[model samples]
Target: MISKWNILTRRKMRGVYIIAVFTTILLGLASRKFSHLLIPFIANNAGDFIWAMMVYFGFRFLFVHKGLLFAILLSFLFSFGIEFSQFYQADWMNQIRETLLGALILGKGFLTVDLIRYTAGILIAAVFDKRYSS
Candidate 1:
């Protein structure tokens, strides 16, 4: 029973989410590639923060009809799950972690501080989404 306007709006929102995800990914990679140019704190935390933001945008893209809170909760769960998964050290998993693509997706190590970074990132992205997505 979707109307034409509703479908168009959903497509537009999905497009915005896709752009957000892509931009966050670029920023995350640039943060790592040019860490020396950034302040020490940003250099240390930007990748994790941006990674979390990208996760939020990705979830938003997939669940375009979901509420903001749903996206926020799901993103936090997914980000935290990935962070915690780093605790497992099986040889097969370690091999995947060693690859460039795998290393980026599955971080090499777990840091408690990364949880804070993720929280901050998700909160910030939610705030922005709430304020602007209306």
Candidate 2:
């Protein structure tokens, strides 16, 4: 049987994976370096969107040919998991969130509104991925 791994390893997908990684890095850097120049609204909201985009790319990397719906579902779940993880505030976990990389990945706190932003991000990514992959 044709497997999901086969779909992910196709030659064409390599470029998409590379692009996703590049875009994720660029967004991370922008969120860190350029955030100060953005207006407060955009600055505050951008991280949630970018995090979702990164999760979408991760889903794409894993499932490749599984298509947009799967990617959206997986990305939303992963994003929600990370956001929800913030509620567990132990010393080790708090220390992890204090570090720069950990802060980027785990986040320091949960925002109820982040769920909306994550859904928006995943949907926007699905539209973009469908348009491109078709």
Candidate 3:
């Protein structure tokens, strides 16, 4: 399927990647600040997943120097960093982290599921990247 679209030719799809990354960062900032506006468990974690995927696909689209292993490592770093960020930053953000689904998605203080989900997300993005993007 990727054989059709010349996604990275003179067209310069860097803008797409840039938009994805920017949007991810923007959403994170929004979640941190406006967490009170979100529904208890669902919104934050769902946002987390989407954010992770956005960053993954954003980087995957932008750079040409990563593999599955690298992507997984990136995912772990991103997830772990975001989780750790919950400990000592963004008061409202921390509140959102207190929910059940939030714990499951953001993770329970520290656990493996978060990492696994990160890897899964990154793997999915990378597969599509290899398959669909030029």
Candidate 4:
């Protein structure tokens, strides 16, 4: 069943997943290095959301269906993963996350609240999956 998705997406999905993996890694690094300079306002968080959507669509539209669960899970994990990174960070990232934008994306210490946001992102991707499969 899912292999059908693999066949349809094989040409495109690999390119996108590779891109997403690279982008996510780069952004994760940036969050560690320049968190203070980048975070600013609520829009900062929205920007993160946009990135998530980018990843989600990259999967739904281009990637294989069998991989979707892991893709979405990785995206969500990326969110919290970056957050935990602050503990190891020097200070700049944490400072930036303190600002409205920083907090929106980088966030503070772990909170249960993050699960809600992750779920919302996943659901949005799932909706895209169900609606666009035709």
Query: In terms of lDDT, which candidate is strongest?
Result: 1
Give all TM-scores, in the order shown. 0.97, 0.87, 0.48, 0.45
Cα lDDT tens digits, model 1, 51-118, are 99999999999999999999999998998988999999999999999999989988988989999999
Q: Report the poorest 10 consecutive residues by lDDT, candidate 3.
A: 1-10
- Pitting candidate 2 against candidate 3, the one with the higher TM-score is 2
Which has the higher TM-score value, candidate number 1 or candidate number 4?
Answer: 1
Candidates 1 and 3 compared by TM-score, better number: 1
As for candidate 3, its clashing pairs are none
Which residue pairs collide in model 4, if any?
40-101, 41-101
Candidate 4 C-alpha lDDT tens digits along 72-106: 77667776576456565557777787797677556
Worst 10 residues of 4 by lDDT: 42-51
Task: State how far residue 30 of model 1 sits from its true place (Å).
Answer: 0.5
lDDT of 3 by residue, 49-129 (tens): 556776685655555345545755676687668766555646676576788656535544553455555555566656765
- For TM-score, the strongest prediction is 1
Candidate 2: RMSD over Cα atoms?
Answer: 2.8
> What is the model-wide C-alpha lDDT for candidate 3?
0.60
TM-score of 1: 0.97
The sequence of per-residue lDDT tens digits that candidate 2 reaches over residues 1-134 is 87877755654775796588569768867986899999988788888887788788778877776767888888888999999999999999999999998998898999999999888888887787778776
Query: Of models 2 and 3, which has the larger lDDT?
Result: 2
